[model samples]
Target: MGIKEQIYNRSPLFLQHLFTTLYGYQLHRERYGPVYQERFRMLLEREHTTIDVKAEQLDRLNDFLHFCTEHSPYYRQLFASHGIRLPLTDLSELKHIPVLSKEILRTHMENIQTDIAAPIIGKTGGTTGTSLQVRYTIPDMQIRMAHLDYFKATHGVYRGMRRISFTAQDLVPERQQVDVYWRMNRAANQLLFTVKRLSPRTMAAYLEAIERFQPETIDGLPSAMIELARFAKREGIRLTCQPIAIFPTAERIDAEERQVIEEVFHGPVFDQYASSEGAPIVSECRFGQKHLHHEMGIIELDTDGEILVTSFDTHGTPLIRYRVGDRMTLSQRICSCGHPGPIIESIDGRGRAFIQKPDGQKIFEAQLASLVKHLPNSIERIQYVQMTTDSVSIYYVPDAERFSQSDERLLMERLYRLFGRDIHLDVQAVSYIDAEESGKILLVKSSLTG
Candidate 1:
């Protein structure tokens, strides 16, 4: 290991950012605490209240420009390629800026990362089944810590309250050390629950941990959260500690799933948008306003609906205009929360879809899941593939005992009700559905595309 990485691994989270000029920890007790309470109160205000969100966005953009040019070799070349100099006065032509793809960013690691006292490694989870190792400087690690603090504070789960985080790393083999370190760093107010072994029995153990720990909040991927909630509900376990919030990140939180989480937690559920390639982009307020964390970076929705992010926090690898594969709507409407950051109405998806057409009319990817949910005791895990325009293949992962002819027939009936008999139904019992490297089960993929 390099001296930089060795130093970073041993360094405390608080000191990590202190060494970085580009990074600053969000002062939760000093500044963010009062602002957080005030923002929650403002959320009670009517949506019509005008908020000056653009100014904050501009401020973030300025910071991003400075951070990129000063520290990131990738951004320096990118700007030079466009024949642009520093002190960019206008973002009007931001669409013309280069979009940083994951592939491109990976190839330029040496220039992308900063030299720190310690080395930080870059990693991708199994959600996409793509495990990537990237390196970080001590400063880069601090930026992440600061971002996490900002996100948690925004949701009122800042200090004094314990957080029980359900992480996908709990299930993976290589991430054990990271899980251990994260747990130790936040030991005073955090409990780490691994989802790697989320069988019925293990899930029961997780439930018991939550009951015993009685954390002030629950944070993890939406998929993991949903699974835990389902297991808890089935077991008749009441997680009624009245946690300040239930925070979901690392995956899309659909309306139905959000409702389920809200029902399980009996409190407000906040959705946090973050990625391996970018800083925390947006977070939802109690009023359901997804306030873009404009303080950290500049983000835009591209013409193709992909989220483009640029962060001032970039020291290791600078991302000027990075295209995050996810989809979202950039709202012009003011959030009832008085935060000056613009709101995102919804995150549509990661562009994964299963095209289904019954009578020449296209069926959305979501409709496949809808069909399965109506089936009698159908397993919630399902995937659909469109072999041809007319033929559709379905893969359903069901519990061992429940995978029977009767269950198949009931599920087919539901599909027939929606798409008629011309569509194909292929159901099977697999030991498990594969999750993306990020540990999110896609549930569906489409060969047929527009």
Candidate 2:
């Protein structure tokens, strides 16, 4: 840890809160400056426009491409090698350029980044075990934050509101003896909850803190929210605090999880699709429709449901035709929300989260989740770990009263049918399944190397 962390670990809870507030103030200054204000104003004005969005997209795409060719060495050579010139009249011509993969970005990061001064650095959550560091210009970061804040504002959440965030941020020290697993960010008017110490034992404390805080907005990993919701329901602990909105981030939430969170929090759950890699925003509207922010970037869907994004905001690290390794189904039907952007039917998270069959076929996370969906609350949580092609280990937390031997048999039978008799299924009931280092639960963890 750093010097600050060393001090924070030794200090008392009140001092830690002071440190967090000080840090939050610093971040607030960085994130919500004049540039942020300007971008936010522009976004608010553009939210309900009838102007030609397609024409504006093309114009922005040309400008961004021109900037990349002029500043970024990697894109300049790649575009030149593909015989692509600046100012492409149509978006279809972008197909000439190759799709940038995660591995390619990691290998060519130095060349890919432009020589900008004082760029903000960010790291990916590394769910696939390959974390990457990305850079963003100040203006780019401001615009991204503005877009996120604007999304929250539309959902009845605004700045200075008391918000509770359950994320992987290391706010609580491991050696702390107190029952407090949270820190107060006075500057941001936010309560930061650590997902590390969350369990049946410490859940009451978390709930008590949240009730006392009375947060207007709850945002963070959906898995953490599900844990709290499941615990609250099982313990019959009804909270009097009703948030204005619950925004799930950093993880994909299915319909069942969404319903549980909404019921527990007594608020609407609005899902969003964005990445730490500075990808454009795809936020859910009030009508439960996911709309792509056309001004932010362009999304091109592949036949296999993979998406290639060209983010206009990633000027510091230009991501043109970047394969972000997430799948989504595009909708053809118009939304009743009156947002003039394309609709995303569903976000199938992390193409890497899959099980490899003996015949080299892949069963994705969403498909694997369906196997346990009919368990009727008997299974609290489940995880699939594939170590080799022939074997898979299933770890699940089952409610003792509800989960019977027949439930285990039914789950095993379903797995056997899905894997065929060739693969080995090792299912075990456990107290809990550990989350990833980032504190986000991965439904499927594959150890096989490609």
Candidate 3:
């Protein structure tokens, strides 16, 4: 066996991946740093090249799927059971393969592979239930990182620039070793904020952190960022540190939330979609096109309103036609930026999160955010649960003071006007509302069928 293979197999799967990261750090310093800068320069050039040429991306999908079918035991068994095989020349042929769900991963957890040689590992956090751990190889992880760089460069965010990452990280007991990553990222000139402590007081602290740090970019789940924006606006506090760009991840960036963020930051907002199971897959450009990161994998938009993704970056526990619980659509036209890649008009969160109407006036959970402006009281956080087409339960987590009887009546009246009196409004109080494990707040949760 080759020396590289020997060393890789000897190391623990997770540790081998860590060493790979160390190697990536060197690669970043010696090669990627310069190359990526040039790539960024080209990306922002007057005449930009198409990121992944259509012909080449088509070819890569065949190789990627075939690799998964061969190396990933879980996918191999799934394909065999479902009468599926890989190596299709055309991307359109992916339809023959059924979409795999998070439930399948949870059930067949052991069948997922761990590449001891060229070792790798990963985790699918907060999707179906608890976060399920997955593994990946060195090549897989590097490809994913490269794709991130490609997307960041495409949107004018580079490595050296200061970035404030507002994500979930615990302070006491030091939850994960990865918490160090956030700090290391900060020391490397990026500031990181923990949404684990995102209260009104904590948000004010976040504002102070931004002012002191002066981050060039802010990246996090859109919900937390929007809440901060709303807090800033209402409290008459303006953060002097207006980042050049704000990249919202982990959740759907609805129009109402977008408007508020843009107003607060006084800049354009870029949205990207990623999941615990999938690599950072798609990014929206300034022209508002949600272009798939073709280099990482082929992301398919099935007519069933599901996103089926197979990544070139998941060699450890490779996913083939993996259903990532989101309902997204491909854009019908080329972007105004002249990029040939597909545009994502919006992400409608998860299936369980969508609200269906018999009258066909389907509503998304995020539509509840619009009611905030319409509410009499300064609504801090609200969770709406649609039990049926005609019934929904509204749970309001009011601000500092308790909701008065008159305030409750007015809020109820407005909600009735919107969803009708048929919907049951159940008012409840909580210390604070939180997003799901993926760090996404469900503005509306439907008790009905997912």
The TM-score values for the models, in the order shown, are: 0.62, 0.79, 0.65
Off by over 4 Å in 3: 1-47, 50-54, 77-86, 114-120, 172-187, 350-450
Highest lDDT model number = 2
lDDT of 2 by residue, 1-450 (tens): 358767988898899999999999988877888889998998888767686878888899999999999899999999889889879888888777899986678667889989776367776633432336688887888888899999999998999999999865657766677899998899999999976556567888998998899889999867667878888999998988889999988677778889999998888999888887888999999999999888899999876667899999998889998987777888888898788777899887643356777765455543465555445445666788998999999887776666888878777865675566667888887887787686656767788742
Predicted structure 2, TM vs. truth: 0.79
Error of 2 at 247 (Å): 0.3
**Cα lDDT tens digits for candidate 1, 108-159:** 6567665433344445421222223455444445555555555666667665
Give candidate 3's TM-score. 0.65
Scored against the true structure, residue 118 in model 2 reaches a CA lDDT of 34
Off by over 4 Å in 2: 350-450
lDDT of each: 0.58, 0.80, 0.61
Model 1, global lDDT: 0.58
Residue 352 alpha-carbon offset, candidate 3, angstroms = 13
Backbone clashes per model, in order? 25, 0, 4
Comparing candidate 1 with candidate 2, which one achieves the higher TM-score?
2
lDDT of 3 at 134: 68
Q: Which whole-number lDDT from 0 to 100 does residue 326 have in model 2?
A: 77
User: Positional deviation of 288 in candidate 1, in angstroms?
Assistant: 1.2
Model 1, which residues run further than 4 Å from truth?
1-63, 114-118, 125-131, 135-144, 171-186, 350-450
Error of 2 at 71 (Å): 1.3
